[model samples]
Target: MNNRRLPSLTPEQCGSRILDAKCIVAFTGAGISTAAGIPDFRGPNGLYTTGKYNADKVFEIDYFHKHPEMFYEFSRDFIQILKKIQPTITHRFLARLESEDLLTGVITQNIDTLHHRAGSINIAEVHGSYWSASCLSCNQFIKNGATLDWWEEQMTQSPRSPVVLCPHCGGIIKPDVVFFGEPVRDLDKAETMIKSCDLLLVLGSSLTVYPAALLPQLTSASTIVVNQGDVMISFRQDMYFILSDLDAFFKKVIDFIDS
Candidate 1:
């Protein structure tokens, strides 16, 4: 982790950063929600790095069919986190931006629905979320609470539990999340938001993951990056770069906006 601090830009400076842009887009990741106590998927204490569960095997579509328990274990914790966590200042700031007509939409890699919770209506969850589940066999959608109840029942019944069956047709049930091998749910909408934006603000991502990572580059707008550490993107000198805690930085920006 790089500890070197980049000079802080004032709220006026940050506000001016996007003043000329008509359409502003925000790209977010796990880091954006970390302030709300959600662990990032690939961060130091993340599922992959901590090795509590194999991210690749658990998230793989085929592998999930063979061993659904692993995914359930992961989902159990994630669901609990979702239940307890609140959206941070950054999330609220973005929502406020939309209200002010300064932001067009949000494109997030996070599966957590903090952006929505924070009151952002124009959001695209590129990686999907735990809010909804789907039946693989029947194509029926189930609410998250219903799926959790069914999963709990399975755990108590038998060691070799039956596959999650759709209530409608008795077919396989899966979360709406985009698994390792699965294609993203709404690529066209995501691309449309990115391409149409005049300013792109990327937050809390290392910019390593593809498809979602490629979005910032697709924007012809001026791109601003705010993260705790170094980013992988090739940002121009004119583009704003704020290397600091996301919540603190955004709080400052919000306060500046209020003033």
Candidate 2:
């Protein structure tokens, strides 16, 4: 998109655009949840690169099938982090927009369920999430998906469950998260939402991962990126870039909109 790009946008200006938009959709990444203590999988000090979690073992589908324990171990800690943290300002702002019928939906690459916790109902978790899990054997989802208490029960067992398994089939249970070889969960739905929107807000993502990263280009809508670091796409003339803190930028936008 080489139309006309603005290098920077004031919070008030962004707020004005949002208020004037009839349908706004947000595309978010792990950066949006980092402020809430959920670590990004690809950030500078993220799980993969930081050596805290092995991406090969955790995200590779074949590896997961072979050594489910490694992924389960990561899951144990991830659930704890999710339990202790709340959604960030940006998350709540989008939820508020959804409630007011201003935002159409959110297309998120994050596995963290903060968007749901923040009360955004029309969300497409393209990366999948821990909200649900299915058995390796029967391919049946945990009765009602999973709850914090369910995870707590599994993780905190006296001897600790070596692997989370399906209660019904006694098969290994895996979170619905998209593994390396797995296709993302909701691309078509998310694409339709993005294409139908008048405005697109990209929050906290570096835009490195694809094909999720390519969704922004699928829409001709005005695209605004709010990220702290480098994004994969070129600074196109048609898009807008705001290199700033996610929550900090949205705090100002929220203040303006709520005013």
Candidate 3:
């Protein structure tokens, strides 16, 4: 529980603070990508909630090793969707902030690589991304984003047991997405930024997951959260919560900033 108690601010006050603040650090999650046609993990129509796919098995390293096809099947669809989706207005706004040097960087729990696609250069992908993959046996690496297409092609040719093999040594190639048991990437650097920034903008996260979820507590910076649903953090003096559509909220904020 937080000891500090701060009353909620009006939208205008929130907008004003955002505009005045320098070194704003954006913390993001799957919810930020939901408007871009990506399903959030715990939402009503989410991949896990719908039971359309077994998320535990799909993201567990042991399960991945045993039934690689299951994970690959999920990845194939995810990658295809990535190719079609564009960055949302919220994403674009954040990128604009970065370009104008108003934002420090983005710390994201997303694996979609949308922040990079949105032109946010300073990003710490806490959960890693599909930007790269590596082979387990020989450590052969695939750096570019071309593996998704190759994986889809393999799945098309062999619907039953499609395997993305390492061309170097016939080893299984796995995307760098952090599994349940895997350690998150760049967390130390992210925490350093979170603790030091003048403003910490949390976007579309429930703040339920461990380690990453603990980041807000580590920051003394003024905090503002914009999300469509309930966020997990308790009210504090330096905190503000906006339960609204992220795109609409950010669009209004951008207008306020420009004004």
Candidate 4:
């Protein structure tokens, strides 16, 4: 990650521009949730710290079928972390923008449902969420937090074993999160939002992940990126970059919006 900081406009300037825009779209990532006490699974002190579950192996559909316990372990920790946290100021601000009609929609790389909890009506989660699950055998879907708790219970009792047998047909049960080989969710909706947006705001993302990473490029709107470091994107003259802590920057923006 590049440690170099990019020049940023004043909070008032950024907020004014966002407020005045007819249609705004936000692309977000894990960084936006860090302030709410969730760890970035790809960051230094994240899952890499333990060196146990390989990202490639753990997220693969085939591997998950053979070793559902591994995914369950990770999910247990994640579910607990999410339960203890609330949406941060940045998330609330984005929701507020949506409520005021300043923002058209949000395209998020995050699987957490913080944006929805914060009252944002229009959201496109490129990555699927843990809030739901699917059964491979019966093709039935369940949407509830209790399902995650049940999965955790199964994991504790059957560690090092696969417990993916579907309830209806004894096949497999998978969390709704997009696995390594799985296609992202809502590709068409994401494309439509990007193409129709008048302004695009990118927050707290490295933009390394493909498909979702390329959504910003599809927009003809002016882009404003607020992240801690450099991301892979062709620099356009209309793009405004802000390299800083997302929570701090957004706090200032919220203040300006309120004023």
Task: Give the winner by TM-score: 1 or 3.
Answer: 3
In candidate 1, the residue pairs with backbone N, CA or C atoms under 3 Å apart (3 or more residues apart, or in different chains) clash, namely none
User: Scored by Cα lDDT, where does model 4 land?
Assistant: 0.79
List the pairs of residues colliding in candidate 4: none
Please list the C-alpha lDDT of all candidates, in the order they appear. 0.77, 0.83, 0.80, 0.79
Off by over 4 Å in 3: 1-6, 40-53, 144-161
- Put down candidate 4 lDDT per residue, 74-154, tens digits, no spaces: 777776777788999889988988888888888899888888777887888889876567886688874445344565665
**How many pairs in model 2 have backbone atoms within 3 A of each other, for residues 3 or more apart or on separate chains, i.e. clashes?**
0
Q: Stretches of candidate 2 above 4 Å error? A: 1-5, 40-55, 143-145, 157-160, 234-238
Worst 10 residues of 3 by lDDT: 1-10
Query: Per-candidate RMSD vs. true structure?
Result: 3.9, 2.8, 3.1, 3.3
What TM-score would every model get versus the actual structure? 0.83, 0.89, 0.86, 0.86
Q: Which candidate is the best by TM-score?
A: 2
Report the backbone clash tally of model 3: 0
Q: Over 4 Å off in model 4, which ranges?
A: 1-7, 42-45, 51-55, 144-167
Kindly give the number of clashing pairs for every candidate: 0, 0, 0, 0
For model 1, residues 1-259, the per-residue Cα lDDT tens digits are: 2323334466568877666668889999878988999876787877777788887787898998788768877766666657777999899988988998989999999877788778888878788875567888777676643333454554345445434556788666777889988888667788999899888889999888888888787765777788887877754444667888888877767676677
State candidate 1's TM-score: 0.83
Over the stretch 26-61, how does candidate 3's per-residue lDDT look in tens digits? 999887898998866667866667676787798898
Instruction: After the best TM-score superposition of candidate 2, give how far the Cα of residue 182 lies from its true spot, in angstroms.
Output: 1.2
